[model samples]
Target chain A: MAINTEKNSYTVIFAVVMVVVVGLLLSGISQVLKPNIDANKRAEKQKNILYAMGVNENQGANDVVFVSDDILQEKFDTYITEQFYLQGGEKVDDPEAYLIDIKKEKKKAEDPSYDQKLPLFKGTKDGKDLYVMPVRGKGLWDAIWGFVAVDETMTIQGVFFDHKGETPGLGAEIKQRYFMDDFEGESFLDDGQFEGIAVAKGNNDPKNEDKSDNEVDALAGATITGDGLATMLRKDVQKYVPFFKSLQN
Target chain B: MGLLSRKDANLILDPLADNNPITIQVLGICSALAITAKLVPSVVMAVSVIFVLGVGNVIISLMRNIIPSKIRIIVQLIVVATLVIIVDQVLKAFSYELSKELSVFIGLIITNCIIMGRFEAFALGNGPWKSFLDGIGNALGYGLILVVVGFFRELFGSGTLFGIEIFGNPVEKSGLYAYGYENNGFMVLPPMALIVVGIIIWVQRSRNKDLIEEN
Candidate 1:
């Protein structure tokens, strides 16, 4: 018996049932997979942090290979000596500092009275002490974020940039080796002034030899993404200067 | 041929050439143009579309009879979106790195008209088995064009295929580069994709005169 399918009542009932069914199915799948997805995200964060501090499995000039999963936790534990964050200008030790959400902190800090927790990882690579900081900012299409590892002098040791929805060939190249490698040896301070690096065009130093100038050659077609990255570095890294200065005293 | 009858086989074969979703029908040109810059991404997107369309066709076909005509489009959209999301969540759980690489493209699958086009045009009037075959055929047709376009773009634009240097290193001035050959930077841009697709359509129509419309 074919029920009258053209009835408005049938259409409304079908729509409601479909919505409820789809909602339940999607929510159930998400709930079941939540733990595994969360674990994967945690592992990725650790990998990114480790990658920024120059501890990675990269072999080729263009490779950005992270350490394998089997030894990732071991490597992370061995390399990262201290995990802490600054809240109200006070240092607080946190074992899971890397997992802190920078986006949420940024939103909360907009209240002005809220003291945002700025997570920092201290590690030693090649017997030289390094500090790794996470930064979040805008890109052409969506959010872009990265981890930057710097030494006591605030010179960039290594960086690992990633984006949520940047264009594949253009803005997406920020994560590529050629662009990220240029950040190395670039100092955040110029003669003790906290002057951030700029992704400049026609800086006349395409080879990036003038690290002291606080400028890296910009990507060919990715002007806005490059500027966003430079701004992100300047704004986010500026907050940590006070703590780094206290280290000297 | 051995498994399927002549009529059934045509359902799987017709879209591959004379009635292709991309070339002949011009249904899903948007994604074909957007993600065909590199061979790997093109292949990945093709495989993803194949999965979504094939499964989506079957689901829509199974529900064709009871689906209200007034809200059938919404129901079809829900099916495609649900499938894409499930695939995305599963990939994120098992293969986080690949999920990251396919971040935007996976979401873009729902927007590909081929899935909805197949559902509305064919699956709504067909059985599950035949609809499945049609879905696979159209997706294969789309994939073929994508791979072809990706091949030319990546080779000329980056001097690489699947990220392997086929024309040698452009930066180090090796192999073809040593002979003063330079990568065409324009080929990597989106406009070049349209030109490449246009060239494919021209070549296809020239070979098959029947496809030419009488104006």
Candidate 2:
């Protein structure tokens, strides 16, 4: 005798069973793989932080360099010397800058104190010290983030930008070296004022004459995303001004 | 029919050419357009989809008889989604970069329409083994379109295939680059992917007379 599989009671029972099974299956898999996923994300973040400090993959025209898992960890340890958090011009007790995610922090609109803490990474290579600052903001469709590094003079040393869902070939160019290179050598302070870099749109050809002007040519077809990057970079950099200035004394 | 028999072989191979899920049925074209810009992600997406479709078909087919007809769609979806989530988690764990490149497209596989179509049209009515073959066939069909588009897109759009420079440096102005062979930037966009698919369908229809519609 075949069961009445199409009965309303059977349908409801099957639905409940499936929901429970799928939920358990997903949760189990996620739990088992959480450690590995977390490690991969941390490694990638370390790689980007390294990139912002000017440590790119082995340079060659056509050669692709593949760093093993151990070497990646070793490289991060060698280049980055210190990690700490700064809140209201004072160094906080948090030594783990890698644990804080600015993307998640940006979502808590109700938490006005969310911006109080900013993670700062100190990296050194070739006897030169660098401060790596993380910035994040909303792009055309999703989150855009990057590490902007500076030197003793507060000039932009290098940048490594990335985006989640920005339009490819347009706003996605931020990840490309050429776009990030525009920020190199650009100063953050304008005559002792904390003036951030300006991502100017449609002003591609000699936009400004002042050499000390903190301005860079924005992506041609990605004005809104460029503007978003500009705003976030300014806001994030401004938060650490007091801490950075305190180091001089 | 026996496994790998003449009839059974057609069940697996026909979709690759004459009856492709992407070209003939026009299913799962969104991912075909979205992830084909780079060969690595396209290949990964194909592998992920094949795994999901193949396992999903087998699981759904085995339970088809006991599944409540009123909730079959939900049942098929649960199986497909469970498999996709597994693939997503594994990708995140092992190959984070590719996972990032694929991003939301991997999660979007549940809505691809090809897997669900296979479940409703074939898996529900066929045995587990036959449904397994059919699922692999349709997925390979979809993979063919995606890989082909990815090859051309990466070649012309970036002067590279799988991130390897093929015809000298496209960015350099000196040496072999002065021939003015600039990368075709438009091929990287969504509209160009649709155009590439149209070209494939056009070539396919021309070769197979039965596929062409009467004028």
Per-residue lDDT tens digits for candidate 2, residues A82-201, read 998876566865557867887665565348865556789998978999999998887787889999989867888888888998888798888876688778888889887899988886
lDDT string for model 1 (A151-179, tens) is 98899999999999888778999999999
Query: What does candidate 1's lDDT look like per residue over B119-208, in tens digits?
Result: 999999999999999999889999999999999999999889998999988777889999999999999988999999999999999999
Model 2 regions more than 4 Å off:
A58-68, A104-115, A204-211, B1-3, B173-176
Candidate 1 colliding pairs: none
Q: Model 1 reaches what TM-score against the true structure?
A: 0.94
Error of 2 at A92 (Å): 3.0
Please give the TM-score of chain B in predicted model 2.
0.96
For model 1, what is the C-alpha lDDT against the true structure?
Answer: 0.93
In order, candidate lDDTs are 0.93, 0.85
Q: Total clashing residue pairs per candidate?
A: 0, 0
